[model samples]
Target: MLKKLLFLFVLAVLCLTFIPQLTKPSSTLVTVFKLTENPAVIVKGAQGSALTVNISFGEKEVEELLGQLTKPYPLLFVDSDWASRFPHLAEEIKKRSVPVALLGVQGQSYETDLNLFAEQLSQFEKIFAARPLWFRTADEEFPSSLLQQLQKAEINALGSTVQWKEGKLPKASKGEIISVSYHSGGRPKISDVKRLMESRTYQSVEDLLFRPTVKTKKIPQ
Candidate 1:
């Protein structure tokens, strides 16, 4: 009986030491998607001439833009900096089922500013009930170290091919990503956005990136 009890205690100690390690998440580098002359990231199954729009601005501007857009809305990059200040916007985004990505606070040093980052992420998840899969910097520029950190966190980094300007609707190409910001000057006019929509179909960033492509079968020629 003494021998059996000692064996059981050893087994329990082994399980306690190894179980948490087995369950811990892996820290691997994830893919970073960005625009380049020779693009490193490609949308594998994209269809047609679809584009994605990412908007980073104030809550009022976002609300106004959301009201103006129809089906296939733009992806909003909510900054942790201002998310707490706009509870109504968060509720509205949740109510509307809008897609979102994390927009890092402008001029943030991710290495040293982790506390703010964590707080913002916590607040965002509290309101949205989930974590975002995508992330981008407010200035559209991401540091290499930050990219690695984001990858370890399992969040993909996204970059824009086109930066929409005030009073001008930049022509977007197929598979291109457009970023609209109030920080550039002011909120983009609804008319410009409408015109862009009329020009071509705009898809959510998630859809454009991950949606499976539908291939047409060629009838016997």
Candidate 2:
């Protein structure tokens, strides 16, 4: 019985030794760099790995800012009036082949707001030649009704920030939210960006965004 017990202990030790450690947290994190009111200054000065940039369409020199985009980074368009204000930016974005997401309703209560949201979506579809699958909002809390409407509109993802949690970099696709880890002030370092770019989780999310949606196979009767 003592020999059997010793053998079991040895086997358990071997198993523990072979098991891999959990290096990352349970959630995946993505990092987003929001362009301040002065995007040109930020873009020109900022240094980091590949990053998704957020731009408000109504900002001045929108074309100039876009023309400066030499590298292919994801772009997030904020404000509902972007299409109406800068109708040609979409064409430029298409030429650049950048991923795009639009700002969505944030806890809108009135029916008029909903109507406006629909109008904005229609405009976006017309401008981009495809519906945007991702959205972001300023509100920390959202209504279920608003969420249902977004889902019904076929939005596949939402974006949030983990900047509040200092020293913690987020992984990609945490539930329905694509959480981003970025510095609140100044630009992130290139080394840090490189790490994010190299992560398997980030690559997985990228592949998911670019992959074509699966269609049901038709069976002949």
Candidate RMSDs in Å, in order, are 10.4, 17.7
Put down candidate 1 lDDT per residue, 79-127, tens digits, no spaces: 7546567777777777888777787755346655655556766776776
Candidate 2 per-residue lDDT, tens place, 1-221, comes to 99999999999998777654344433213233222221111111111222354444333344544554444453444444655566567667777887776655444442336565577678777777767655555332334444445556655334333322223456543221123322123334434544544442232224433322221111112
Residue 12 local lDDT, model 2: 94
TM-score of each model, in listed order: 0.66, 0.47
List residue ranges in candidate 2 displaced over 4 A. 1-50, 57-72, 78-80, 109-112, 163-221
Residue pairs whose backbone atoms clash in candidate 1: none
| TM-score, model 2 to reference | 0.47
TM-score of 1: 0.66
Name model 1 segments beyond 4 Å from true. Answer: 1-59, 111-116, 210-221
Candidate 2 has an lDDT of 0.45
